[model samples]
Target: MHQDPTENIVEILLSKSTVKQKAYRNVCRAFKELEQEAQLLIDVISAKTTERDQDIKLSVEPVSDQEFHIRIAGDLLVFVLHTNIISLPEDYEYNKSNYVADQPLRKYLGQINVYNFMADSFEFNRLNDPGYLLARLLINSENYFIVEGERQIGFMFKSISAKPLDKVDLDILIKLIISQAADNDLVVPPFPNIRKITVREKLEKTQSLGAGNKIGFQMSYQNETKS
Candidate 1:
């Protein structure tokens, strides 16, 4: 366990290439608001004391009274990056819900399941993530209310209170995600719902438009303040 929890997170998310890294990056980018709302602790302890693994798991228990439950699991070569911890060693085979006896493929299936368990957390996190500004703008338009012909359908849309998320916004919330991908490329996974989906399309849009490394206004301001 690293002395500073965020440092352990940063090390694993930024340096490690194992399976768990992807989920960690998403949690960081998508759940930054939770940095304030939730208490995040870094703990290293044995699991299977054993429905899961002899590995690492991220255990997410809700507060005394709350709206969410988040847990991420770790495997032999990976550390769970969410709330509940689940780590099992290799060569120990049980009936995974998505099992086909292909361990690597099956592991990912389980990984994705563990990934989805906290879907609500990520969705709530989305109201604060990048594309969310756009989603919110759409929601807020007086035009935000759309009437197709006679029946009310959905909301119409307009624009941001500002110029919309430009390069800097993309850098802070979007590319930071891409920079940590396994292939080191910005991408969107195939899941359709924003909550279920990884922000790969946003990655493509930013890269295509020539957005790359940059800093957030908040971080930049802090740096200047220090200097």
Candidate 2:
């Protein structure tokens, strides 16, 4: 009797890893919910602030399946939804009873990350623009989440187990993002010379743009003429 060489391949392809599938579902659901919540908040804030003489405009753009951009008061807050599994440190405080499973455990965490950058950074595609991680939603191996950084958010979920994100959780997450964005100190704009250099380079490269905006010499780049 000859064994089919493709038997193992077929079995492997058909094999279902229920735990991973569930984790992936959890991540996707949470991100989608968060996206919806953020949009609603933007609408509410825009409506309430529209009557002011000079209202700050907030814009949310979807960068990718796992990423979003929120512009508030000249700051760009990038919220990234990561689907990769993560693990908590052994030292992390949690009740083992919450994650009792038959199989040997592994730490798999998912993350919802927030980063702050200058509004013009994304506008000009500056890869090196200054930014920092304001917060993270960590989904532990047991499909529970614990938020890191941003005390307000951490405190919100401190008592709860890391479970799939729901409407309430999404709402709070959006609020936390807005809260961080409202704190102007979090985002540091690029140096004045940096902006000038970037604008100068763009003007030099694009012929359609007039030279009137050029700043004479590029302060960031050195010119060398070899003999």
lDDT of each: 0.25, 0.61
Residue-level lDDT of model 2, residues 182-222, one tens digit each, is 76353223465334446666755443222112111111111
Error of 1 at 27 (Å): 30
What is the lDDT, from 0 to 100, of the residue 104 in candidate 2?
Answer: 26
The most accurate candidate by TM-score is 2
The runs of at least 3 residues in candidate 2 whose Cα sits more than 4 Å from the true structure, single-residue gaps closed, are: 1-16, 94-106, 140-143, 159-164, 186-227
Cα lDDT of model 1 by residue, 27-74, tens digit: 333333332222232232223323455453444454322123333331
Q: What range of 10 consecutive residues in model 1 has the weakest lDDT sum?
A: 218-227
**Model 2 global lDDT (CA atoms, 0 to 1):** 0.61
CA deviation > 4 Å runs, candidate 1 = 1-46, 49-55, 68-200, 204-227
TM-score per candidate: 0.16, 0.67
lDDT of 1: 0.25
